[model samples]
Target chain A: MVKQKGILYDSTMCVGCGECYSACKKQNKLPETNSDFLKDHLSANTYTVVEQHGDLYARKMCMHCAEPTCASVCPVKAFEKTKEGAVIYDAEKCIGCRYCMQACPHQIPRYEWSQVSPRVRKCVLCQNRISKGLPTACSEACPTGATICGDLDDLKIEAKKRLSEGSDKYYQHIYGLDEAGGGSVLILASVPFEKLGYTPNLPKQPMPQLTNRVMEKIPTVATVGGLFLGSMYWLTKRKNEIAREEKEAKFKRNEVK
Target chain B: MKNSNASKLSFWKIVAAVIMICGLYSSYIRFTKGLGASTHLSDSIPWGLWIGFDFLGVGLAAAGFTIAVMVHVFNIHKFEPIVRPAILTAYIGYTLVVLLLIIDLGRPQNFWHPLVMWNLHSVMFEITWCVICYSAILTLEFAPVVLEKYNLTAPIKILRKISIPVVILGVIFSTLHQSSFGSLYLIVPGRLYPLWYSTLLPVNFYISCIAAGLSMIIFESYLNARAFNLGLRLDILSGLAKIVLYVLIIGFLVRITDMIITGKTPFLFLPRTETYMFYAEVIVGTFIPVYLLSQAKYRKSRMWLYVISIFTLSGFVLNRINVAVTGLVASSKTSYFPSFDEISITMMLVVLGMWAFKLVSTKFPVFVELENLKEEKLPEDSREMILSE
Candidate 1:
């Protein structure tokens, strides 16, 4: 029903300023994490973070994958990639299996570890902000326009343009372009993505694609297999039992004689 | 029925109730205190002793399906005496698995949600349904024993008439879910180490279950001999071991083929802890037992047969843990290790399951034939009388 696309972030243009992190926290109403070493709330409550790597700073959040592992494995249908390309979570439907936590390749989803009934917390791409014709909290807060939000095709064009002209600075690869089946959130980084904490070895094909193929066999295996096996067991046992009965009857007749 | 002392049952029942109460308390803590506080599970290692023991309980309990297949399907008259007791063991073991699952679920209350709102795509969802249906099938298949114990001959006859269909269905369901348990991890291909990953995981699981199930029956028969003071039935044990050895040979060969086809042969040759463990399972669990059982002299030796049973069980446990936990070594966020509380809770469930089994066997006609007991006892008594003269 609703069409979906997302932002492509060029990490090379990003300044190490905490503007996006603060804006996201403010927008989401997340509490500030008071870790002694790390003052950023993005580790827990803030949905996205800006990590400082040497002279460059990378913007990190949910990749909004086309075939999300979280959505596939969530025993309860909690984590959903909405038609509009936002990977959203509903706390009400959450079973707290943390299967989403286990399934996620990027490890983007965070849980309230201390709570008895914890919910998975992650980015929804500031859907409320975008509905009001404004960019995401981090995108609006950015001074250099490093974080660009738009349609998928538009972002791809932008990414390719930057890759071709800015070869001296760019890594030639467009991270998340084909990774995990073309996620809504794309990243164009100057350095190797491994340094920025991206899963470099992840298969380009979506995680869900692999499992969906495997799961398609469940109906046949569970129902049809059950029936066939059950029937064979029935016939064999009945045949033997009847033979045993006949033998016993003959033994009784002989004894009577 | 021979041990129909009400006082004895009541005494044991009280002990059982106390143990169950403690397990319930641990379970309550598991739910209320969060997994971090209740068990040794961590983000890196979400599964622990409960999963391992679940595999152990299921593998050991394979006796039920194997014995059922032998007595009913294959019409193996020699193993008929073992069929009822084997079914009872299976019933007990499955009940334990259900209990362990509850303990492991982060939200146990939401467990029924899968049934209420089905997830047809989820292998775990399918397994949940299969186990439930199969357990019911087993109950129906085993009902004649309970009816006969109560002297309900008419109902027992009716049950016997329909038992063929029920048992066939149960076997099929058992096979499906047994393999589906392995397919459950197919979702984590990227996370699961290549050493253990195989598109043929479901097939591998089913084969191992068959081998484990047969060996378990052999092991249980030995336990019965010791417990009941019935001298070991070397003939039956050896016969059963021969079957286990056959199944293991097929299963091992399949595994080797799978590894080779998947190009994971390099992993087996390469030095790694998981690879080494895999080798140990293949060698000690399947190969050694196969070789020993192949020899007429070794198969006849009671001590050697017992040793093979232990090896088979260890191998079974290792294979299951590899599928459930060890396979996910690459994706593990932290070092996965079982915690102390997890071990205790796991032990608590096992002890309870065993105690329940003991109570049922003593009170019910689980071991239906006392002819073997009588036949053996008469010889010793007569020999003593002649010696005194």
Candidate 2:
């Protein structure tokens, strides 16, 4: 088995029931999180949430991307992409640098602030449950089946089938289908994703793709720079040597004369 | 190392002990209370005083690498006496950055993730690696003095033999990381206010660091003369001031070009704090310094040179903070100010760095002008051989 899988969520069908949020907390043993704005809006404990749109609802979670920026930017290999297409973080190794937070395009990674030793909190897509052949808590608890999980190919087909059936009920776009180098989680909606707080400006290319051209040149610059400096040193030393020798010869000639 | 006519033995020792105790207490709070509790940082302002000071400290300390390159690589023997002190200043500044980073990191323990995970694309990774490497190079380059202090003559001889290569390596590393610091903000194009954001951020950072670094050396020299009654060398300092003038002029030119190209010049006139800071940074930091250093008589004055350096240093500090926090916070909809604990911790770290520098310089013979053996009285034939080598 390739182990790569993901979820497709249709926001048009979401009823704002929030069964997915409650189910996720129970299944994952997550502590109770109050999403009230009165407190700090961003935190480490609540990995995912249900966002409200004008007439629709959307689920916000980690994208589990094929090209994960968080994984790429992490210096210590603290973030690992499992074969099952889940980007898992090892708390034991995380140094709390927050570089991952800066790199993620969707801004999915949340920091644990209330605790003494905070860890990065994010949706892992329940890899443990998936390994045991069970649906994630959100999908299982979804009353209207707004969320579905399966192979990426199968999810694409399911999304297409809904789009073609058209009836003007579903929008023609899938939110994460190709955004940020193809995230593991996909979305379908009647309204446009931007209206639901999804970032429409993210590039289709992977985050690192924009930076690789620059990173590749770092070593070359260092090497050539080193050589140029060394040569200058050699030349300057030679000039000083010549000047000193001339001064010595002049002193000796005067003495002999 | 103790001065014969110096003040009471108990006074300086007590001061050092008191500073050490305060620093230790601050460190304890930082470790036990967590960053949020100990720091004034919030989501709106991720970076604060520590980051601000790091830029200021490192930018001023750029004198270290710049002087090293001139003396060792460019073979400017005129700057030879100042090289070791400059390098030492850079070493301390870089070390402080690491200390500040530890306090800044939310999970200080996970700091190793960047090295182990190999995030090859992140600018932060490049910066982290470059800083670590450069610090090592600085340590190696400064080792000859330590070796000589301990009378380890063989290692000193070997270090002299490799000094050229080490200096070259140090220059390369410093350039990469200095620009990398600016590049760290490049990816945040959307978040960084338009006034501070520029495609030429890396280049701007490099040039400004060099200019600020030169000014710092002049300022430090002035301070030393006053504090220790060291002889003032007007010839070399004025020569350095000229270079500083040229760099400031170029830096101002670049800032203007960047603003025009990015069409951010219009924003400079807007009724906003960023606009105000933008002008303050450019006008006060660059333009004024350029004007001050341009005059021959002004450049010759130790007092005026120090004053201009202080202004230049302040401008650099404000520019960094404006970009990293002030400009950013205004847009993010939350006002972030460092709590008392945060400021205290930052001050404590700075005090520690100052004390460490004083201790090291007092004990070592770094700033002394040691004449070569060839220049000393010796047998003529042997002196000729030494001179040739």
Candidate 3:
């Protein structure tokens, strides 16, 4: 069986070396923008960034949720959660609605807005490398094991171990373990995840589930509601026809009398 | 008098021509230069004025089904006169919405992808289908008017036979999609502010749209009366206002009750921009119109009715804009303001719709009284007949 792969990011260990940033650009073959790389957030050209929160450094990218809202919300299924545990995108199928960007709980998806033929851009967990039995470039380039790539189950165990063993250094919580409903990526930080600019108030339940609850009712509503409306037309038409007949009959009886 | 009317028409024609020219140029820039260069949209705020206007268009177009239900299903013959124009307005409104969607989409050529691609979980997918199906339904419902103009008696007879079922389907489609538009926001509870977000968002949207739709019918009637020299049907206008009043009451109660039940009422008192906008939307859009229309004197008066309808329509516009734009403001890092080109294109669509409506009204029997319609046998070549006149 193909194991679901994921990344464990240890913010406490990251040295803010900018190695992962350079490695990611090289791996993705994206042109380096002239803008200050340290100051940049995720964009069409940049998928991952190492954010500095005071003294500590954190890596920010797609959370790649177990039940990704972007995949669920895409009308064309352009985004798919692969068995390899990466949420990959097919630009060919994309109609460029950019709804994926809107529906993402983490707001990680970026768009090539300036291009005449734009594509929704974001981290795919380096699916191509993972499929080829290789770790992501950022993970392989990290000197201090700050970013580790492995099976998601193993990463969860490792994340918990670090949190419990180094309680003095690491924050008690694993950031992505249950955020927006159990993302594939896990983060162990010394400071609160919110201090690292993480969205603080995500529900434990998956965002897609919120939409699905309402969307699942559509078929039932269409069927039952269609029947009700159809019957209403019949009933109202019948009532009007009977009323017309009765009026004519009464007029005929009066004429005969 | 004839020359004055002709001058007035020419003036409008010139204005529409200028707007359309500007719109075409903006659209050219939009298509060639791409979304980044043309509009003020960014990754954080992906949807902007175009989407907001799309919401407004759909909300205002709610009249198509509301009037259809009243006249055809409930057998409210008094509203029968306004039904054609209501359907026409809906058709024009929906056409503009589809046009805007195409313009907003990054891959406008791939607009047809939704037909074969099935993502039933997405509200947007559902909405796309509903709009398509509803537009076809609107076309069928409005076909009789076109048929009547062309003096196609046989098809008219057939259409009349199927009209009831057609109307029922129209209402069903409108209901599903109108509420589904609200459902579009339900996924964004994390992003949309608490003041505007609710699981009951769909229900609120459905109800408010009914009130707004009814008001639109009244507003259009007033416009039709002024533009076409048709006498104001005071009785019909007053009756519609009564229905709008009832809908407004129900909508207000539902919204307030939902807020209380969900324990989100405290958010209403928050000293936030969204909170103030929310108050303005509810008070000016809903409460004031309800109060004015509730009075018999205001309902009977032409000026009061016109002014109240405008207020109601503005309130509805504000509500939609709040949901689509304002509510999402605090969450995004980048603030969005629509560029000049964006506003121009929106204005162009409005002018285009108005021009088409005027043209059709003149060429067709859209404003004819239902009672008088039976007495007139129009020529087969009505276009030529009108031109000759």
| TM-score for chain B of each model, two decimals | 0.88, 0.89, 0.93
Task: Score each candidate by Cα lDDT.
Answer: 0.74, 0.77, 0.87
User: Quick one: best DockQ, which candidate?
Assistant: 3
Provide interface RMSD per model, one decimal: 4.6, 2.5, 3.6
lDDT of 1 by residue, A110-183 (tens): 76655666667899888776655567888778888888887777988899999999989899998887877768
How accurate locally is residue B111 in candidate 1, as Cα lDDT from 0 to 100? 69
TM-score of chain A of 3: 0.95
Candidate 2, A152-172: lDDT as tens digits: 789888998999897498878
DockQ (model 1, Cα): 0.34
Any residue pairs clashing in model 3, and if so which?
A: none
Predicted model 1 interface RMSD = 4.6
Against the true structure, whose lDDT is highest? 3
**lDDT digits (tens) for residues A1-257 of candidate 3:** 89999999998889988888888999999988635666778999999998777888878999989999998888888889989889999988888888898888899999998988799999888999998879988899999999999989999999988888999998799999999898889998888889999888789999888888888787788788778867775686677777777878999999999
Per-residue lDDT over B1-389 for candidate 3, one digit per residue giving the tens place of the 0 to 100 score: 99998999899889889999999999999999898888888999999999999988999999999988877776666677788888889999999999999999988878889899888888889899999999999999988889887789999899889887788888888999999889988888878988889998988899889889888988888877776656666777788889899988998898888889989988988998999999999988988998898888998887888899998999999999999999998998668899988988899999988888888877888877833644444332222101100
Please give the ranking of all candidate structures by DockQ, highest first, separated by commas: 3, 2, 1
